[model samples]
Target chain A: MILEYKFEYLSNNNTLVNFLTNIADASDMKFEITKEKNEINFYVDADEEAMSSFASTIASDLPMSVFLQNTAVSLVQEMPPSNIQADKTKQFNLPFCPKCLQKAESAESSDYYNPFTTCPMCCDTKDIKEFIVSFGDEIKRTDAYKEVFEDLASRIHQGLGVRFKTLSGTFIFEKLENLQEDKNQKDIKLLCTNLANISNVVVAKKAEIVALACIEKPQMDFRINELYKSKNIIQAKRLSVRYPNDLILYLLSKELRALGIDFLSYKNEGSYDINVDFENFDAKESLKIPKLKILEQNRALVLESENYDKKFMQVFESLKEKNKAHFMVLLYENSLLQKRILNFYTSSRDDDNVSYYAKDLEGFLDVLNYRLPKSIQEVFEDIQKEESGERLLKNYKNKYPDSIKTALEFDLSVLKNASIVSFWKIAESILGFKNSILDNASLSLLEKGPRIDYKLFESARIYNKEFNYIKLIQSGMSFRLAGVDERTISLGYIESYAHFISNIADEVNKEMELEGISLSGDIFADERISHYVHKSIGKNFKIFYNKDFVIQTRF
Target chain B: MNILILGIGNILFQDEGIGAHFVHYMDEKYEYISQKNSVTIVDGGTLAQRLIPLIVRYDYLIVVDCIEAYDSEPGDVYFFDFENAPDEINWQGSAHEVEMLQTLNMIRMNGDLPPSRVLGVIPKRIDDDTAFELSEEIIAAADTMEQTVIKHLESLDVSLRERNPQITISAMAQISFKREIVNDSGI
Candidate 1:
């Protein structure tokens, strides 16, 4: 008797289907496999022993993909006519499977210690070679791939920065302890080998861990634990952490693990002690199904688009040209929320026209002007002239001796020329807090804190046309002056800003009848900001973010 | 009538900045009649909604920017009324285009939008690295754009007088490029 089993696999991508087909071909059982829509049907000459063995093998080793929504297996009555054909499924560029990893470590195998080694069950080696060739000349093949990685690991262990090309791009890696104190560490990322390694460094939730281990391994910012914080390896309270995505990094991570080093700090572009020059391969861009996309970064909560906009498709079909339209909003930490506009005819996707509008703080002040007392103006000018917060506070303390009292009584026009940075600088001084990096100051408030609502910043008009950033900053300052904790003040500011931005977006969408909103920029990566923004927006309009690139693309 | 000529584009990209370059070109070469009708030229840059207060105050608006049209060749110039935009014309290619259109639509919804027309050209080189030079095709097309704008202004009872010698777009590009290089070097 012949028996059939059908398995329903969700996802449009061919990764799971390819994996199943490859695994079936490797099995000794005489089985026919066919797919109809999302279901994969298998027919076997019912040898119970062979069928049970094959089923157990599949159950033990199924490839993990975020796109695989659900799977179900059930016995079927009938099988379609056998139509065996050549396997033409596109090979996914994914991490090595358990079998491939075993082969890579075995000395008897041809793929032993080969960084470029891949099988039908894994990624396409030919595509990898082609991408590497695109970087430069032909690759110099060698049997000493493992030796090279070991040497690189040794150098990194010796506290030297080494540059090497990953599947994504070139990066420089160094021990966190070796990083210079004065060096800018804003863009630095902590790369670990696995979940256990990452957990040792930072405090991460289960969702965050799952996100890091996912196929599209994104760099996530997490608060450093007490142990790492006391070590003072990095200055920031929160560190961007990520797991190794490429083979070379994976191998290097193993070698580093042997040396008792679990993680390293890295940045995309920098001067390094050693350059590991080799043919660089590129990873095929993965299909990103955002779990929790806040602005541009994808986190743990899966946010999937339900369906294509029918109205947009209708407009697209009516149009005669193959031109692209971009609706982008860029939100940087210290800079103004910049809205870039460009609609142009292009021969190809590469022909992207770029432009920028340059406006100084004076330009912003001209649009949102406010009046202040003469005394406050003098104090603001003096504080602005001081180079550091310490100096600013010292000068003001010597001059007035009761500057905080004055700050509490009346609104100051100091914010006229203030960006986010200057706002933090002035606020820190008045609140008796030491100067901290903007990211650290913000992250410090991630902990649960008291909720305090201060008076809204006094604006000239209630519904101002432009974003009243100055007033928002002033509101935070008021809370701080009113003896609220720093954490509470930070939470308050984030909430206020989120509400303000969401309201503006809602108003614009209502007025323009736009299909959706597009949010970009790195500042949106902050946990509180992302949470509040999404909560405030609340399904009123579809939110679009970058799928190909992270919110903050390095280099 | 209060007439406003707003030039928008990013100068960093090669031909993407043709609209901005054209405004500078117009400013240098001609002086328009402003007695009867107040005419203002603004290098709007990549700004969209931020210019709402300034844009709506005018009685008539002329926008100069890069545009994409179906079945159009590089350097193809297009002129159309904003209210009655052609089906073949698309302003969804880049961020600023969508934003500028959205800004106009928002204003229209509030009944504050003025009678507006867009004078745009198909750019030849926008993907190239930072450069101020316009492509030869776009440079030639600018003449057609200039003449059209002049004719429209004339219809509004405004005339242009040649106040200075004709300054080539290339010369304007050279000046802008030099200024950028200096600023970058922090000299």
Candidate 2:
């Protein structure tokens, strides 16, 4: 008796169909796949014993994809004729499958020790490898790639940095413990081989783990576990982690696993002991979250859209052409919006595009039409000339006595030109730290830290048709003056900023029916800020993000 | 006068790529636009500020791109001078459009902005899905836009000579979008 099994999956891509087809091809099983509007169905015919074996293999070795939402297998009475056509799904950047990995390791196999060994189940790396090999002697080409792989593994084992190409771009990798003395380690990400080891270092849910290992291979920030925190594996409370998403990293992981190394730290830029060069394969960064992408480098949660607008094209076109009051929320470089009005084009002036960060205190004060005392004006000018934050504070206190107290009493006008520089400078001065340390203060307090009450800071005040960011910054400064811990103050500032962004979005959405709200810039990569904005305004309107590009500013 | 015929758009988006494809359509079909004027055509693919230096070098600029307009249907084309752009035409529709406007403004501030005219079409589709192929509406509109740009260039004292066995816009799109050279003339 023939038994039929059906599998259902979600995702617009053909990754599942490709994987199933590969599995069927290897097992000599006949299967048929059909894609409906929402879900894809796979029908397979086999005997009871064969069916059980196939299901077990699939369960043990199914490739993780951010797109694979659900899979269910049920017995069917009738078997349909094979309608399997040539697999035309876009090739995904996936790690080697068990079968491909075995082929790479076996000396008898033609692909033995080949760094670029990959099957159709993963990516089209074989074609890439072939294209590179076509340039030179095939044997020498294989030997060179082998040498590079061996050198990479040796360097990784020696606790030295190795530079290698990923599908997206070239990266530098070193063991996390070895990079303690490395001063330029800010953008580094801890790489793990599997979810089991990843869970040992960071606190991650099952879904988050799946997202990290999925095809997209986005760097996800997670709270470092107690053991890692105590060990100080990374100085920060939260660590960004990723699993291997390409062939080179996949092979590297195998070597790392054998060496008993759980994690390796990698950054986009760094000098390394060894450099592995291969034919450039320009790979696009895949989607982290299917619909709503937050923090391009971090965790992505694939959520299904129930009310997805089919006429999004029509809406986008209409917004682009005729909508005068529509605001483009560009917070990436710095929070600024381009309000397309009649004056924007007719007048070729720079001030038409207002910057979120106040260029200078005097200019900002001038814009608000607030007349500063002659002494206070000179004091600000002196502070601006002071290069260091320490000196700036010292000179301010000496020149304008009780300035912090005075600042507390001042009613700020707009959040648009709020001094993000001033907020950071004040935090740095009080904490006796530099800009780098203070820059990460908010993110360090993301997962676990003391929370300050909202009442402590002045609520978001609307004045002169803008949100008051200066008042919020002043409140944080006052708290710092009151001897609040840096962690608590940082948490407070982050929460306040999140609410500020949400409030701005809400206010804008209320004014007119917008085509859609766009969120750009690397600043949105902050989980706290992105999450708050999404949760607050995501329900009301469609928030568009960079589809082809990562949210992080590349510069 | 030195003339620069620039087409700007992201080819990854279906109809959003009409401008980039149109320039290639022009380049492939026309060998020399005029002997009197040195005319160069460039496919400025999603580049905004980066094209400013190249644009300023030319005395006259003709930009082929997509624009959003009030009460406009897909395939509708609008031709207007940069100084006197219609209020109905919104250049703030896409990121590239916004950047292009800023680039022009920056040039104007630097006192280097050329006399520029835009030949824009109402695109039918600009979605997350990547495609090199144009929508049926945009494919039909390409001819009208091509005529408009050519007419504007000719009025600028720039003549045109069509290449023998001229390549169609659809064929050019296939070559550009797929990165494949089609041997079959029928494509």
Candidate 3:
């Protein structure tokens, strides 16, 4: 039996596309949806069976926080004991004002719903619950979701034209324990499909979901010829259906076609595939990678590095397609070299509402951290100001007096020398550098026999860990003079390192607050401000204003 | 809970002795375990059977061994928890009876078994008869085994008794592609 029910609703503002997608995914069985404008119309077909089960499933996985009386009850109010002889022998309680027992009033229905706050003048349970506006910080963390869900449930019972199927006229019901166990999406979908298959009732996630129907699942399920496909499917030139696997048949077919694979047809209702020719395709064959590779297109080249012109260019030949955006390139921001490009690119495209998110660790930090690196530098500055730093520097100079002395101290001159760069590269590494950003970097640490020649601080992890990373950022070469080849040299290695000089220069974005300096609200919010300030100070000091992301605008 | 790790290796031959060498460090000075932390450490001494009880009792059983998977780096770490299996198409049988890929295949796809991992550190050679005569270069990577374990455990929302780890975030791939990558990359 087929039954039709419809209702009008004003689309609420807060519903996002994701919410809609979730609803569609959950209600994938029985009801078919056709969207025109913002309105969704559902067409359902099933015997007057399984309606209650369907309703319970929808009620359970509503993405809501609470349950209301209406969600479980019917719009048709239970008749108040019509045939019963009135309870004339009712016991009496303390006398109360006649007005206190007044039925629900509707002067302003939505706003007057608090049971406890019933006006001393009149009592009402008919009104919808008023919005609880004073939900504090705790609610932001949770709570408010519960209230909304409850409200929607209650609204359902308040006579909203709800339809109930007749199956010997017995209403099916469910318990909460069973619903609570349906936690994950998979389980929820199963429950909804299961419930709708047995119980003949309908349910809605929102008060707005008007048209709901439940159908039965035939044991043999041979109603296939009766079903028709939506026209939208036939009109589709492109459709994006995201699955857990990237090995999509449609995408594979397109790729196969591009490689000149021949004549294809639907193999079976289950599955089919065509073998692709990987030989010619690997050689960057006739197929050209598009500028902005369309989603689900044959192939897309993702930009992983921001230095699109140089370092990326060096490795471009390695990529199958030399020139193309493919789908999109995910760029890392930490590379001082790439930051240079982004610095220019951001300013140039600022007018186009261009937002660049660096895919690299350093780039991600520089953009997201707001002020971490700078704070690290500030901490360094604080440490430097301590009387102990002078003693440490003086002691090293006295001990070495020459090469060893210069290298022992954090000196730019000594750090720049190849010998020190090589030596400290090993020293700093041995001390601790393996797990940093430098882990992915390409650099060598040189050791000079048993005397501890230097450390090469090759990995990006160097800056994140080493206590003296800020000191090295000031005059990277001088770090070698400190007798430790402990300094970041790779343009992509340090988040704060910039390229202002002939080579990639160090730049620290030190974020901090000195004893007397004024600060912004963020400084008080967390220690993050100080850390970022230190790195900012370190990067800012090192920047010669050459790289775009680092010193994108100025020197 | 304190995590006790037993790394058995011989980096001398390339990748064979790495497990033993790694255990040497993990049981000795690896910051994750020995870093003045509440964690305990043990050295399996390239002796798998001897450490069976210890491996089974520990919250996690991490085996750092040289799995002959063709061309892999001296210290490249292959992480596989028996609970999460690789795809069947790629999971050709491995030499060991308790093949990590195979075990994981059973657990993840078929939903059988529990949690444990058999890390296959691809080495240059397995020595004459899986002897622990690691080269100086391969021996140098003993520290990485500890790092790999730390990274993997952290992904499960766990922290060692001491020592914070460095985390690297990667982009999310589609599930099927993810499965392929996990299999290939772990292999």
Q: Is candidate 1 or candidate 2 better by TM-score?
A: 1
For the predicted complex of model 2, DockQ is 0.01
Query: How well is each residue in A1-555 modelled by candidate 1, as lDDT tens digits?
Result: 355655554333455556666666778556666766446666765567777788877765555544333455656656666544434654455666656666777889887777667766555554343112111343444447788778778888988787876765678888877865445555457787657767678888766776666554556667788788788776676676777766678788888888888788887777787665444344344322232332323232222222122343443344332222221212121122343211111111122111221232121111121222234444455444532323334434464456566455445544442233344444554554443324433555343222222122345442322332333333343334334456555555556555545545544444344344444444455566667667756556554443322332222
* lDDT, model 1, position A56: 78
TM-score of each: 0.46, 0.46, 0.18
Q: What is the C-alpha lDDT of each candidate?
A: 0.57, 0.56, 0.27
Kindly report the fnat of each predicted structure, to 2 decimals. 0.00, 0.00, 0.00
List model 2 lDDT by residue over B6-111, tens digit each. Answer: 8887664568878888887887666554657777777766657657657878888888888888989999989999899999987756766777778888998999
- Cα lDDT tens digits, model 2, A119-194, are 7666566545621222123222344555555555666888778776666467888887786544555544678875
* DockQ of all models, two decimals each: 0.01, 0.01, 0.01
Which candidate number would show the highest TM-score if scored against the true structure? 1
lDDT of 3 by residue, A1-555 (tens): 332222221121122222223333455534433333323333344445554554454444333211111212223212221111212232111111122212112235432222222322111212322223212232221223234334322332231211111111111212111222222222111112221122211111221111111010101101111111132211211111111011112222223334332112121122111111111112211111111111111111111112123443333334342111110121221222333221111111111111122234342121111011223224334435643344433443454355333223433333322221232242343233333223222222311101111112234531222223333432222222323333233222232221111011121212221111111111111122222323333333321111111111111
Give the backbone clash total of model 3. 127
Give residue A120's lDDT in candidate 2 (0 to 100). Answer: 67
- lDDT (Cα) of model 1: 0.57
